[model samples]
Target: DMEIKNTNTIQYRSMVDKLIFLTNIRLDIAFVVPYVSKFMQTPQQTHLWAMKGILQYI
Candidate 1:
């Protein structure tokens, strides 16, 4: 679990937005997207990595 303070807020927000948009059209990542999106305001490196993994899957 990575700390939220050290993670990139901008990138995390961007990715979460993208994932939310994608979730509207893609069902596969819907579950993970919401799980990770829960930390939108204060995301960690681990959350970012999880989002990256989902993005890579797509």
Candidate 2:
């Protein structure tokens, strides 16, 4: 089994970028994408939890 590491600079950037692009077509995720982006500099467990919740909403 492997543990999931929530923070990976390149991967996180890539994902956030994709989410930003998706925002154009999915207005519903717009707010959440930016919301998640703000924590990129120093993401914490709570931020990841929030993002998961947002994803579930979407």
Candidate 3:
């Protein structure tokens, strides 16, 4: 199991926080947002990619 850590956890969390806030207005992402939020404590590259995908989705 080779897990790569996200270099910018702060940025990742910030984005996730914003996504959580957006969930109130964009119900489409409500489900996925929480899914990604699960990795907030120790986000990895894959997690960050998921977040980016969410942004693209919006």
Name the top lDDT candidate: 3
Off by over 4 Å in 1: 1-7
RMSD of 2: 3.9
- Which TM-score value belongs to model 3? 0.83
Best by TM-score: 3
lDDT by residue for model 2 over 1-58, one digit each (tens)? 1234434544455667777887888898986787789878656667666766765676
Candidate 1 lDDT by residue in tens digits, 1-58:
2444645877888888898898878988878877887888877678778878888999
Better of 1 and 3 by TM-score: 3
* Prediction 2 TM-score vs. true: 0.62
TM-score of every model versus the real structure: 0.78, 0.62, 0.83
Which segments of model 2 are wrong by more than 4 Å? 1-15
Q: Sorted on lDDT, highest at the top, how do the candidates line up? A: 3, 1, 2
lDDT of each: 0.80, 0.68, 0.83
lDDT string for model 3 (1-58, tens) is 3323444687789999999999899998888887888888888778788889889879
